[model samples]
Structure formats: structure tokens, C-alpha cells
Target chain A: MNKLMVYMFKNFIRMLLLLLFVSITAFILVSLSPIDPLQANISQTALGSLSQEQIDKLEMYWGVNEAPIERYLAWVRAFLHGDMGTSLLYRQSVASVIMQKLSNSLMLMVFAWIISGGIGFFLGILSGMNRGKIIDKLIKGYALLTASAPTFWLALLFLLVFSVWLGLFPIGLSVPIGMDAASVSLSDRLQHAILPAVTLSITGISNIVLHTREKMIDVLESEYVLFAVARGEKRWEIFRHHGLRNILLPAITLQFASISEIFGGSILVEQVFSYPGLGQAVVTAGLGGDIPLLLGITVISAAIVFAGNFIADILYGIVDPRIRKGARS
Target chain B: MDRIPILDIQNLSVSFSQYVDMFRKNDLQVIKDLNLKLFEGEVVAVVGASGSGKSLLAHAILGILPYNASFSGRMSYCGEPLTQMRIEQLRGKEIVLVPQSVSYLDPLMKVGFQIRKSVNDKRSKEKMLQTLNRYGLGEEVEKLYPFELSGGMARRVLISTAVMDSPRLVIADEPTPGIHIDAAKQVLGHFRKIADDGAAVLIITHDLELAIEAADRVVVFYAGMTLEEAQASDFSDESKLSHPYTRALWRAMPQNGFRAIESIKEADL
Candidate 1:
């Protein structure tokens, strides 16, 4: 237990250092870009008659007039004190704006994760158990097809079929335009979430299914599995007792490693569906040169990636006893 | 000596279908015309070099051969035909196998739970602990995983797992390799005790000395065929061995001066 605590502490330190590095890099890159946030903000408004004095005041207020390093250090200081600065694009606190969008993205991610993980695991076991059979072949075909198709195109295709033609789901937005979100029914939220969630899930499912199938096949052929069979353990019993944990350990590592890809893929899907999620938020922030909002989103996203890996490492220690021993000694 | 044999295998042959190309297929005959038997209260050791189909014989009896391997054989256990279904039913209860690979233990499982085969009852748990104790393993060892064990401990755990139910028949495939000499002797001694308790033990090994020391009978295999079957005392002198290969193996023993013979390849056999 002390060893596990030390392991977690070390990983926490590493995650903090990585987040710092990401923040610095994001700040520097945004500073080096040609687009000036004040100019972008000014151009976005209908203020052709505004005086130069108003522009100067706006620049001072936003700290754009300060040296890039000075501004970054000030931002970091405030961030450490729980202030993520005000967004130039939305004219709201970056934290408040991101919190609203973060929840929406998390909801989409949770639904996609559960759907993809459950289906992928089940299909993978079936395909692996019946290798070279028709079910295996069909799953392989689906994997190949989804792997080749782009996420945005798939999302659009879903939208066209389910929304435009069939009218099964809403075309865009996470909620009805006129309906108050707080007053909306649970079924209304689910109906609005289905298209974007499914679009995000399909790609993840394909990747996970292929990975799980490969790992399951390898585990099924291992000496221990064969030994279990020789002991006359029933097929399901062998799978449950021996096969599932072994296969899932590596599969989970792969899943967590692919989290960045999933995050990136969700951006395109979110755009296609106009879902008010972090992915869509990041895209809008980037285009509008909202550096503060972009920096906030980037740091949070990197933190999410690091957290995923950290969770995977902890799970590794739990699942494989060798890892726990290694952590101790 | 008229007791019905616990296991009787006659004219057992195993051949595997192999794909030579996309078009051509061939049958690779691995074992042919092998015959062996084990009566109650006896330990029989099948001794041969690697690739001599010794392991395949054990797998065949256990009905765990690969999907493509086809075999023609008559195998009986306790005076009844040992069909696949019957073997499946009897396995882990009436018959058990101690596999050769240390990798055969599940890496994720606790030693005690695995030995009990996940039977959650208090009786089985106590029995599992007793089996581990008989193998000279401490109670704490039950909580350790396969990776935590030394080679000898792992071998003992495998033995403990097989004998937990006091199986009627036990087949151990190369159960002593890589273990210390004393540990090997201890394992073989345990097999002797199992036999004395009325279970038939078949040990497959390449160590002729161990076989001669531990087993009541020795069956020699050469190039996937049974070369000779003899009383273990027959191995005391090279001249008492009936087959040239058996005599060659005896002479090749370290105690017998490690005599060298002309290389006889599989093609020559």
C-alpha cells in the first residue's frame, strides 16, 4: 500500500509537470501566431465607428500590451489561484464557459464510452472464440469499413440519414432552440444526444473491437488457457475465470492510449452535429483567436489525457499481480 | 496383478493436417502404433527425447489435442472406453494432468483459489491448503501469484493443483525440468506416494535416471513410436533392455559413461 501510494504520488508529479509544459507551449504558440486577439475581437463586432482610445483600453484590460512572458506568468499565477481569466470571445469567465461545455462533452463521452466498450467487448469475444467463422468475418468487415471512413463524414452521413431524411433526431444543437434546458425532460436530452454520441462511438467501437479480438485470440491460444481446457473447465467458465481478466488488462491499456485520438475524433463529430461540447468550443476558440479560452481548453484536454493514462496504470497494478510486486520492490 | 488397468492405450496414432500451400495439404503423422497401460497402485514413466511425441500422448489421453489433429486410437480407463465426453466429465475429478510449462498457471490468479478451481466452499479451501502443505508450501504461498514463485515452487503448485481432488489417474508431462535435483526427487517421491494411495501415475519425462528411480515401469519412445516397455529394473543393465534404442539411451546415461552412438536422424528412423 505504501508502494502504491508512492507510485500514485510520482505519477501525480509527472502529470503536473506535463500540464505545466503544455500550458507554456500553448501560450507561446498562441503568442507567436499572426492573429491579434484584440484585433480579432474588434473585427468580430459591428464597431466601425469606435475610436483608437477604446481599442487601447481594451488591449490594456486584456493584458495584450504586456510582454508575452509577463502575460503568461500572470495567467499562470491566476490559474494557480483558481482564476482562468475572462474569455475575449464570449465576454464571460473562461472557467464558467468551459464548465458548461465540459459537462456536455462529458455526457457525450460517457455515453459513447459505455456503448462502444460494451458492444466492442462482446463482439470481440464472439469473434475471437469463433475465428474464421461467418460472424468473425462479418465483424472484421465492419471493423475495416469503420476504420477506413473518416469521423466527420460518418457523422454527416448519420445526420443526413437520421435527421434530414428520416427525421428521427434533431439536426443540430444539444437541446431544442426554444425549450429551456433546465425544464427539458430526460428523454428530450437523450434524443438530442443520440446522433453525436453514436457518431463518436462508432469509430471507438471499431478500434476497440479489433484490439480486443486480437488480444482475446492471443490469450485464448496461450498455454494456460489450453491447460484450463485440459482440466475440463467449461468454455464459459474458462473464459470468465482465466481469459477475460487477462485480455481486458492489455485491451484497457490500448483503450486509454487511444484516448487522445478519441478526443480529436470527437471534435469533428461535434462540429458536424453542432453539439455544445468542449470539442466544438475548442474549434470556435481557435478560429476566433480566443487565446485565453483556447489555452484553458488545451490544458484541460491534456489533463484529461494524462488522467486517462494514470487511471490505466493504477488499473494495471490491480489486474496484474506482477505489476504490484514490481511497484513494491 | 490381475486388476483391471486404470488406463489402457493401444495402437494410438496422431496425425495433423497441414497446409503446404493455398492449394496443397498434407498429413504429418506425429505418433503411430503406441501402446501403454497403467494398473492401480503403479507409476509408469514414458521416457523419450524432445519431439518424440511424449507430450502428444498425454494430451491425447486428456482429449485436449489441437483442432486439426486427427487420431486413430483405443483408450480405456478403468475397464471402460474413454470417449471424449467421458474424459471431459472425468477430468479434474477422476483424472488430472500436471502440465510441463510453468506458464500453464494463470498469472492473474491466487495459488489457493486456482488450486481449488474457484470452488468457494470451506472444505475445498481447506483441502487446497492441505495439498499445498503436503508439497512443503507455506500457507502464505497460497496468496502469491504464479509470477512470484520460483521454478520449484511453481512445479509444486502444479502438482498440488492436480492432486487436490485425489484423482484416480494423474499424467505429469515433463514435471521435473529446471527444478533442483532435491526438489525433483521430492516431486517424484510425491508421485510415488500418490500411486501408493491407489491412484495410477503416468509421468512423461526425458530424464531416464529419474524415471528408473521413481517409476515401477518404464516405456521407451523413439521417433513417435513406442520402442520398448520394460520393468524399471531392466534399466539397471544395458543388456537387459530389449531394444537397441533403449540400450543406446541407457548407455547414454551420465552414470553409464555417456556413450556416443552414430547420429540417427528422423529420416533414418
Candidate 2:
């Protein structure tokens, strides 16, 4: 128990450091960007109509006139006290905006994660067990092609085929544009999410498929597997007993580690789909120079990715007793 | 004492087809005309140098040769011809293998579950516990994974896994490697005990001293061929050995002055 506590404490420290690094990096890059917040958000006509004194007041209010260091310190101070400031673009609290956007993105990303893992694991097992066969070759070819293809390109292709050509699904957005929030059903949201979710899942699936296939091949060829066969175990019986558990750990590790990729890909996927998710919000904040919103998203996304890896570490112990014993020691 | 042998193998030859060029393939013979008989209540040791194709014999009996390997042989179990289908049926139930490395045990699985295999009946569970107890292993050892075991304990666990089904024939492939002398002796003794209980035991190894100590008969393999097969007692006198290579091996024993003729290759002798 004491060891577990220490391990958790260490992880907590590492998470804090990662959040700090990500926030600082995002802040620096945003600061260096040539896009001026005032110029990007306010029209030229509005700037021309304002008097010099009024423009000074507006600049002060926006914290544009403040030094970069003082601005960063103030933002950090406010953040420590649960004040994520307000979004320059949305005129709302950064936290609430993120919360709303995150819920939508979470639904989309979770669906993609689950679907990719399930399909990838199944395909990997098939390819690995029947290596050099026609099915293996086809799966390998598909995985390779999909892994190298760009996420935005795939999203456009899905949108064109499913929405434009076939007229089967919506072209874009989380829901129908004029639909009332109260009137929308689960089916409506799912119908809208299916395209983007599938597009995002396509890229995620290839990596898992390739990694898991390699791991499955290795497990099948291990000495223990040979012994299992020598023990009179049938092919499927050996797979059930010796192959599954050994391969499961590596698959899980790859699954969780791919969260960063999933998150990264959603940025492009959300843009192509025009979905009102955190990924789309990130682009909005980045373009409009909403530092508070961007920094908040940065920290949260880092935490989420780190949390995924942490869960994988914990699961390693549960899935394999050897790792658990090693941790105890 | 003229009863039919429990396991009979004759004129067994194994070869592998290897690609020397893109189109040309060569057949590399690994085992040639290897013949042996193992009766119930006796242990036969196929003694040879390490990597001398002794393991191929065990693999041959289990019907697990690789894809490119081919064999021509007659193998019978209990007076019946052992075909591929027959070996498949008998393996893990009537016949079992105690493999060479500790790695042969699945690292993720508990020892008890591995021993019991697919049988989950209360009677099989009792039998598993009895087998472990017979090997002087505590019940707690069953819950431990293979990595948690000491060398000797793991060796005993491997033996227990093989004998749990009360198999008619047990083939142990180089079971004593990487273990201390005393532990090695203990493992050999376990095989001897298994044979004494009316199962035929085939132990493939390179340790002539250990073989002569534990086996009823010893077969010497040189260049993948059976050069000599003699009673264990015949090793006591060099003149009693039929083959010149067998006499060279007897003289090479440490107790026999560790002598070797220049004509015999160091690897083979």
C-alpha cells in the first residue's frame, strides 16, 4: 500500500510538470504569433470609429498593453484560484466553454477509441494467426495505406461519399442547424457523429492493428506456445489459453498510448466536419488569439492524455501478475 | 521379460529442406536411422552432445516438426502404429513432454492451472494437488507464476505438469540444463520414479554421467545417428561397449581420467 501511494504521488508530480510545460509552450507560441488579437477580432471600421482615449481603454481592458511576463504571471495566478479568466472570442468563462465543447468531443473521441481498439484487435489477431495468407496481406495493405493517409483527407472523402454522393448522412455539424436543443434525440447526435468518428477511428486503427499483429505473432511463436501445442492443446485452445492473455497487455498499452494521436487527429477531423467540439474550439481560440481558452485547453488535453497512460500502467499490473509482482517488489 | 515395448521407434530419419539459392533447395539430414525401444517401468536416455539433434527425436514423437522438415520412420505406442492422428489424440493425455527450458511454462499463468490444463473437475483438481505434493511442492506454489520459482522448484513444477495426467509415456528434453548438480540429480530421480511407476520415460540429454546413473539403457548419438545402444551397466567397463565412439565417451568421463583420442572431434566426444 505504501509503495502504491508513492507511485501515485510520483505520477501526480509528473502530471503537474507536464501541464506546466504544455501551458508554457502554448503561451510562448501564441505570444510569438503575428496575428494581433485586436486586429483579428475587431473590424477595421470599428477601429477607425473609436477615439484615441477609447482605444486605449479597450486595449487596457483586453490586457494588450500589459507586458508579456506580467500577463503570464497574472493568468497563472488567476488559474491557481480556479479562475481560468474569460475567452476573448466567446465572451464566456474559459472553463465553461471548455466544458461544453469537451462533452461533445469526449463522445466523439470515446466512440472512435472504442471502435478502433475492438476492430484493430480483431483484425490484428486474424492477420497474425494467418500470416502470409490472402487475408493477412489485405489487412496489412489496408493498415499501411490508412496509417499514411492524412486525417483531413479521409474526413473529406467520408463526407463526400456518405453525405454528398449517397445522401445518407449530414454534411457537417453536431446536430441539425435549426434543431432545438430540447428536441434533439440521441439518434440525431449519433447520426451526425458517425462520419467524423469513423474518420478519426480509421487512422487510430492502423497503428493498433500493426502493433498488435506483431505482438500476436511473437506470442504465437514463443516457447510456451510450442509447449502448449505439445501438451495436445488444439489450435484454438492454445490461442485461448496461451495467446490471448500474453497479447492483451501489449494491445492495451498501444490502445492507451494512442490517445494522443486520437486527440491530435480530432483537430483536423473536427475542422472538416465543422463539429462544435473542443478540437474545433482550439482552432477558434488559436486563430482569434484567445490565450486563456487555448492555455486552458492545453492543460486539460495534457491531463487527459497523461491520465490515459496512467490507466494503462495500472492495467498492466491487473492483466499480468508478473508486472504486479514486480511492482510489489 | 519379453513383453512388447511400450514405445518402439525404428529407422527414424529427419531432414530439413533449406533454400541455398532463390530456386535451389538442399535437404539437410539432422537425424539418420535412429532406433530405440522403451519398455514400461524403464527409463531410456538418448545421450549426445548439446545441439546434436537429440531434441528432434522428442519433437518427432510429439508430431511437431517444423514446416520444412520431413521424416521417414516407424513409431509405435503400446503395440499400435503411432500416426499423426494417433499422436494428436494421445499427446497431453496418454503422452506428455517435460520441455527443456523454464520458459516452456507460460509466464502469465499460475502453476496449478497449467498443471490441471483444461480439466476443471473436482477430481482433477485433487489429482493436481496430489501431483504437486508428490513432488514436495507446497500448495502455495500452485498460485505462484513460473518467474517466482527457484530453478529447482521450477524443474519440479515442469515434471509435475507432465505427470499430472498419469501419462503412459513421458519424454523429457534436456530437463537438467542450467540447474545445479544436486537439483539435476533430483530431476533425474523424478524421471526414474515416473518410470518405476510403469510409464516409459525417454530422457534426451548430453550428460552421459547423469544418463548412466538414471537410465536402464543408454543410446549414444553421434552426427545424428545412433552409434551405440548399451545397458547402463555396460558403461562400467570400456571393453563391454560395442562401438569405438562409445569407448571414447566412457574414457572421457571425469572419473575415468577424462581421456580423449586425437582422432575424435571434441564436439562429438
Candidate 3:
């Protein structure tokens, strides 16, 4: 118990440091870019009659007159206090804009993640157990095709088939544009999400299936598993007790490591389907030079990545006694 | 007095089907024309050099051979024909194996949990603890993982796991390599004790000296065939050993002047 506490504490500290480093890097990169948020907004919004005093006032209001490092420190301080600053693009608090879109993306990701993980894990075990058989070969081919296919193209194909031709699912968005999301039924939300969620999950499922299949094959061939069989352990008992536990740790680590790529793919899928998710929000923020909004999104994404790896580490300590012993020592 | 053998294997042959080309296939025979029997209250050490099919013989009896390997043999356990289903039923209770590699221990499991396996009853737990104690392992060692154990400790744990159930037949495959000499003898001594308690123990090893010291009878194997089966006392003199290969092996022992013999081809043997 003491060792577990210490392990969690250490992981927490590492996550905090990683977030700090990522925030600093994101802030510095955005600050050094050619685009200036205040100037960009002013030139786009103002007519030719704008005065120099007005320009200076806008710069002062946005804290652009301060040094870059000072501005970053101020942003960090506000972020630590749960204030993500104001967005020049949306004319609202960055937190509010992000919070509004975060739910949509979270819904899509939750569906895709659960569906892909379940299908991938089940098929991986089947293919691994019956390696070189017909089912294994079929899954391998499917994995190859899906892993290489472009996400946007797949989304367009789904939209063409399911929305335009069959009319089975809505083409885009988490909820209908004019309807209040709170009043929407759960089934309606699901109907709208099916096309985009399936598109986003195809690649994730293929990648996980391939990774898990390979790992399970290695685990099955391990000497201990063979010994378990020789000890008269039932086939299911060996898989349940020995095989699955060994396979799950690496599979989870791979899942967490692929989060960024999954997020990147989600953006392309969202844009193709016109989904009202954080992916679309990030696209608009980038094109509009919404620095505060962009930085806020980057920080949240970094936090998710850090949390994923942190969870994997804790789970490693829990599932594998060798690691737990090492941590305790 | 004719005592009933606990395990009997007759005319055992093992071969694997390998694809030689895109279309052609060949059968590679690994073990052929093998026969052996083990009676209760005796330790039979099968001694051979590496690649002599000793371990395969052990795997064959345990019914854990690789998928491609095909076996044609007659085997019986206590006068009943031993089928695959019967072996599964008897394994780990009536019969058990001490595998060759210490890697056989699961890295994810604690030593105690692995030895107890599926049985969590009070009697099984007490028996496990007693077995571990007999092997000189402390209580704390039960909580340690396989990687945490020293080579000797892992060997002892493997022995404890095999012998805990008081099996009728025990097949140990090269269980003493990579441990201290004294520790090796101690492990063999434990197997001897098990045999003395009436279980038929088969210890497969390449160490002729150790076999001669611990076994009541020694079976010498060459090129997947048994060359000679003799009392361990016969190994005291090279002339008393029957086969030429067995005599060569005795000469090759360090205590026997380590004489180098010309390579004998399988066809000649």
C-alpha cells in the first residue's frame, strides 16, 4: 500500500512537470509566430479610418505590450486559477468556448474508443489463438486495408452510403443545429453520431487489432503459458488467468501512446462530416489566429495525454508483480 | 517379485511435417523406436547430450508436444492405456512436470499463487507452505516474483510446485543446470525423497556423474534412441557399460580423463 502511494505520487509529479513543459513550449511557439492576434483582429474588423491611439489601446488591453515571457507567465497564472483567458476569435472566455465543444468531441471519442477497443481485443485474441488459419488471414488483410486507408476518405464514403443513399444516419453534428442539446433524446444523439464515430474508429480498431494480435501471439508462445498448459490448465483458464493479463498491459500502453494520432485523425474526420466538436473548433481557431483559444486547446490535449500515460503506469504497477516489487524497492 | 510399472512407453516415435518448398513436404523424425518403463520407488535418470531428444521424451509423456509433431506410440499408466484425455485428467494431480527452463515460471504471478494454482482450499495451501519449507524457502519468498528469485531458488520453487500434490509420476527435464553444485545435489536429493515415498521419478539430464550418484538406474540415449539401460553401479567401470556410445560418454566425463572419441554418425550407431 505504501509503495502504491509512492508510485502514484511520483507519477503525479511527472505529469505536472510534463504539462508545465508543454505549456511553456506551446506558448513560446505561438508567441514567436509571424501572426499577431491583436493586429490581425484589428485590421480585419476596423475600417481604414482607425486611429493610432485606438491601436495602442487595443495592444495595451490585450497585454501585447508586455514581454513575451511575462505574458506567458500571466497566462499560466490565470490557467492555474481555472481561467483560460478570453478568446479574440469568439469574443468570449476561452474556457466557455472550449467547454461547449469539449462535450461533443468527448461523446464521439467515447463511442469510438469503446467500440474499437472491444472489437479489436476480441478479434486479436481469436486471430492470435488460431494463427495462420483462415480467420487469422482474413483479419490480417482487413487490418492492413483499414490501417492504410485515409480517415477523411472513409468518412466521405460512410456519409455517401449511410446518409445520402440509405438515409440511415444524419450527415453531421452532435445535435441538430437549432435544437437545444439538453432536450435531445439519447437515441437521437446516437443517430447523429454513428457515421462520424464509425469513420473515426475504423483506423483505431485496425491498429489496435494488429498490435494486440502480435502481443498476444508473443504471450501465447511464452514459456510460462506453455507450462500452464502442461500443468493441465484448461484452455480458457490459461487465457483468462495468464494470457489476458500479460496482453492487456502492453495493449493499454499502446492505446495511450496512440491518443495524439487518434486525435489528429478525429480532426480530419470531424471536418469532413461538419461535426460540432473540438476538432472543428481547433481548425477555426487556428485559421483565425485565436492564440488564446489555440493554447487552451493544446494544454487540454497535453493534459489528456499525460493522464493517459499516468494511468497506464499505475495499471502496470497493479497488474505485474515484478514492477510492483521494483517500485517498492 | 514383479512389481507393476507406474508408467510404460513402447515403440514411441515422433515426427514433424515440414514444408520443404512451395508444394513439397517432408516428415522429419525427431524421436524414434523408443521404449521405457518406470516403477514406483525408483529414480530413473535418462542421461544424454543436448539434442538427444531427452526433453522431447518428457514433453511427449506430458502430452505437451508442439502442434506439428505427430506421435505413434503405446503408453500406459498403471496398466491402463494412457490417452490424451486421460493424461489431461491425471496431469498435475497424478502426474506433474518440472520443466527444463526456469522461464517456465510465470513472470506476472507471485510464487505462492503459482504453486497453489487453481486450488485455494486450506489443505492445499498448507501443503504448499510445507513443500516450500522443505525446499528451504522462507515465507517471504512466496511473495516474490519469478524474476526476483535466484537460479537455485527458482529451481527449488519449480520442484516444490511439481512435488506439492504427491503425484504418482514426476518427469523433471534438465532441472539442475545453472545452479550451484551443492544446490543441484540438494534438488536431486529432493527427487530421491519423492521416489523413496513411492512416486516413479524420471530425471532427464546430461550430467552423467550426477545421474550415477542419484539414480538407481541410468538410461543412456543417443540420436533419439535408447542405447543402454543399466544399473547406476555399472557406470563405475567403463567395461561394464554395454553400448560403445555409453562407454564413450563415460570416458568423456572429467573424472574419466575426458577422452575425446571420433564423431559417430547416426547411421553407424
Candidate 4:
């Protein structure tokens, strides 16, 4: 337990460093975008309410007149206290906006990951079991084609075929707002999620399939596997006992990388379908130069990547007894 | 003596498929009409040059031979035909193999984990620890990784792990292939113990001296064919045997007693 704690502590430090590096980089990049929020807001005259005095007060209230560093400090202070800044477009707290969108993206991410990992891993195992069989060849060919097919393009194609052509879904939108989160059924969200999930999952799943197949093939030929066979241990025993345990290391590393892939899914598929998630929020923020909103999304995305990698590190210590011992020592 | 041999192989011919081309591919006959066996309480030493299908014969009996390899003959465990049995049915329950190189063990895992893997019962830990101590390794060996040990240590660990469950037959391929001269005796002693435990042990090596010292019987292979089979004491005197290959091999050992086998090449071997 002490060793595990040490391992966890080291991992925590690593995550913090990664988080800081990402947040700083994201803050700089968001600040670099040329659009000014106040400048974008004057044109909201189409809503036809505010006078010049009212606009000036609004600018001062949000610290638009303050120096860049002071404005950054002010936002950063509130941000540390859970204030993500107010969303100008949504006319709501930035935290509230993200919370609403985050769940949708998370649901899509979870479903897409399950689909990609499940299908990819199964095909990979089959391909591995038959190194040069026709199925292996066909899967490889298909994976190659899918890898080259971009996510946004795939989303558009799904939108055309599934939504537009067949009218299978609600034309790529989230669950209608103001509905009770509890009464809003799981299957209903899943129904809205199919095209976006597929748009994201197919390529990732194919990549994992290729990787897992190669890893399984390599592990199958090891001396322990032969030893296991000679010991009269069943084929499945060798696979699960020796093979799966050994293969898990690389599989998990790929899983860590897939977290980023999941985020990438949201950007393209979510934007294409206007699912009102982080991707859509990012677009709105970028268009209106909402630096605080963009910065918030950027840091959260970085945190997710850092957390994914941290989980991988913790798993490494568990799976590899050597590392676990080292931590103990 | 037992009425049925622990294992019996009769006129076994194993062939492997070679995907030479699109149209005219041919099968490579890896082993041909080979016959060998291990009897009750016997230590049988198979001596051969590499690629002579000695290992292929081992694979054939183990039922882990590649899918392309096709074999025809009688191979059985205590009267049951191994030729058609599943790998799980034939191996470990009746026959267990300790591979030549000890490198395949997960470098990260300790000695205890590798041993306990084959013997799946939870209480096997105590038995494994006892076996490790019996092999003259301290309890520290159980805690150390493969890399932390010497070549001799790794070989012993491999042998100890193999015989943990005391299975009926243990097949050792080139058991002393990469072991130090000091470690070869220790490794061979392991097989001798297995055979003494009333389990048939098959030792595969090119070193006739080691075989003569360790085995009750010796089977010689030349170019994937068994050329001669002789009792261990008979080969102790080199002049008694007359197969040209085994004779020349017996002559080639510079120091008649315990000649070091640096390599197993056939020509320059």
C-alpha cells in the first residue's frame, strides 16, 4: 500500500507538470486569436436593446478596458475558485455552459470508445489468430482505407446517408433542452449519438485492430506460449493467462492515446452535427473572441489527456511487477 | 517395468508447407519416418544437430507444431494416440516441455509468479517456494527478476518452474545449450531428479558426455533421422558404437571425459 501510494504520488506530480504546460500553451494560443469580444458584441445590435453608455458599462464590467495581464489575472483568480467566466453568447456562467455540453461529449466519448475498442480488439485477435488468412487481408485492406478517410468527411457522409437520406436520426442534434436529465432516456441520447459516434469510432477502432493483431501475433510465438501448450494447458488458457496478460501493456498504451482520439472525435463530429458540446462551444468562442471560454475548454481538454496518461502510468506499475517492486524499493 | 510405455512414437513423418509461390508451392518434409519413445522411469537423451527435426519431433509430441507442418504416424501417451489429441489434452497433464532458452520468461515477473502460473492453485506458492529452496536458491530468488540472476540461475529457475507440479514426463530441449559448464551438471541433476521421481524425462542435447553422464539411454539423430539408440553405459566407451556419425562425434570430443559442447553444427558444427 505504501508503494502504491508512492507510485500514485509520482504520477500526480507528472500530471500536474503536464497540466501546467498545456494550460500555459493554451492560454497563449487563445490570446493570440485576433477577434475581440467587445468588438464582436457591438454588432449584437440586431437584438436591438443597448445604447453606447450601456455598451461602455458592459465593457468595463467584464474588464474589456483593463490591461491584458491584469485581465488575465482577474480571470485566473475567479477561475481558480471555479469561475470559468460568463459565456457572452449563451448569456450564462461559463461553468454552466461547459457542464451542459460536457455530459453530451462524455456520453459520445464513452460510446465511441467502447465501439472502437470492442470491434478493433476482436478483429485484431482474429487477424492475429490467422496471420495470413483472407479475413486478415480483407480487414487490413479495410483498415487502411478507413484510416485515410477523415472524421469530418465521414460525419458528413453519415449525415447524408443516415440522417438526410434515410431520416433515421433527428438530423444530428442533442436531446432537446429543458427536458428533465433523469426523464431523458439513455436510448434516446444513444439514438441521437449514433452518427457522431461512428464518425469518431470507426477510424480509431481500425487502428486499434491493426495494433492489437500485431501484438497478439508477437505474443503468440513466445517461448512461454509454447511451454504452456506443452504443459497441456488449454489454448484459451494460454491466450488469457499468458497472452492477454502480456498483451495488456501495449493495449493500455493504445487506450491512453485513444483518449486524445476521443476528443478529436468531438471536434469534427460534434461540430458537423452541432451537438452543443465543447467543439461547438469552441467554435462560438473562437468566432466571438471569447478568450475566457476558449481558454477554459483548452485547459479542460489538456486535463483529460493528462488524466488518461496518468491512468496508463498507474496501470503500468500494476501490470509490470518490476515497476511495482521498484516503487516498493 | 510398466506394460505400456509412458510415450511411444512410431514411424512419424512430419512435413511443413512452404509458400514458395502462387502456383507451384511444395511441402517441406521436416522430419521423416522417425520413431522414438520414453518408458516408465526412464531418462532418454536425444542427441542431434540443429534443424535435424529433433526440436520438430519435440513439437510434434507436444502438439504445438506450426499449422503448416503435417505429420503421419503413431504418437501416444500411455497407449492414448497423441496424433489426434488437443494440445491441452497431451501436454502438462502427460508431457511437459522446458524450452532451451530461459529468456522468454517475462523479465518483469519474479520466479514465484512464473512457477505459480503453470500450477494454478493458490496454495501452490508454498510448494514453489519449497522447490526453489530445494534447487539451492535462496528465497531471494523468488523475489528477483530474470535479469538479476546469472545464466546458471536463470536455467535453474526455468527447470525449477518446469518441474514444480511434478508432471509425469518432462521434455528438456538443449537443456544446457547456453549454460555455463559449472551450471550444466546442476541442470542435468534436475532432470535426473525428475526421472528418479518415477516420471519419464527426455533430455535433448548435442553433448554426448553430458548425455552419457545424465541419461539412462541415448538416441542419436543425423539430418532429421535417428541413426542410433544405445544404453548410456554402452556409450561411456566410445569404441563400442559403430554408426559413422556418432562414432566420428565420439572421436571428435578432444578430452574424452566431459568434453565441452561449444556448438552443434553438423559440418563445421
TM-score of each model, paired residue for residue: 0.89, 0.93, 0.84, 0.75
Task: Count clashing residue pairs in model 1.
Answer: 0
Model 2: per-residue Cα lDDT over B1-269, one tens digit each: 67999899999999999999999999999999988899999999999888789988899999998779999989999999999999999999889999987799889988888988856799988998999999999999979999999888888888988988788899999989877888888889999899888899999999999999999999999888898999999999988998878888888889997987447765553
Q: Roughly what TM-score does model 1 have, to 2 decimal places?
A: 0.89
Shift in Å, residue B215, candidate 2? 1.0
DockQ score of the complex predicted as candidate 2: 0.73
Q: How many angstroms is residue B112 displaced in model 2 relative to the true structure, after the best TM-score fit? A: 0.9
- Can you give the DockQ of every candidate in the order shown? 0.66, 0.73, 0.63, 0.43
- Model 1 regions more than 4 Å off: A24-82, A179-187, A251-259, A325-329, B1-3, B265-268
List, in the given order, the native-contact fraction of each candidate: 0.70, 0.85, 0.78, 0.67
lDDT tens per residue, model 3, B1-269: 48779999999998888999999889988788888889999899999889877888988898988888889989999999989999999998889999876689878778888898857789988888898898899988878888898888888899888987779999999978967788889989999999999899999999888999999999988878889999999999988987888888889888898999768777657
- Give me the TM-scores of chain B across the candidates: 0.96, 0.95, 0.96, 0.88
- Write model 1 residue lDDT over A21-127, tens digit each, in one string: 99999888888877766666666564566678887787786667789888888889999998998887889999999999999888888888878887888888888
Instruction: Look at candidate 1 and give me any clashing residue pairs.
Output: none
For model 4, residues B1-269, the per-residue Cα lDDT tens digits are: 55788888899898988878887769888677778878878899989877778888778878778877888888778777765554456466556788777665765456677777745575787888788888888888877876677777778787776776768878888889866676788789878888888899998887777888899999888777777889988876777786766766776676664344445456531
lDDT of 4 by residue, A50-84 (tens): 77787788777545667777767777788788788
lDDT per residue for candidate 3 within A58-136, as digits (tens), equals: 7776556689888888888998898999987788999899898888888888778878888988888888877899999
Question: Which window of 10 residues has the lowest lDDT sum in candidate 1 chain B?
Answer: B260-269
Q: TM-score order of candidates, best first?
A: 2, 1, 3, 4
Q: What residue runs in model 4 are displaced by over 4 Å at the alpha carbon? A: A1-97, A118-148, A160-168, A177-204, B1-38, B49-53, B72-82, B86-88, B101-169, B180-183, B196-199, B220-231, B234-238, B241-254, B257-269
Superposed on the true chain A, the predicted chain A of model 4 yields a TM-score of: 0.86
Q: Where does model 3 exceed 4 Å of error?
A: A1-86, A132-142, A180-190, B1-4, B19-26, B138-141, B258-268
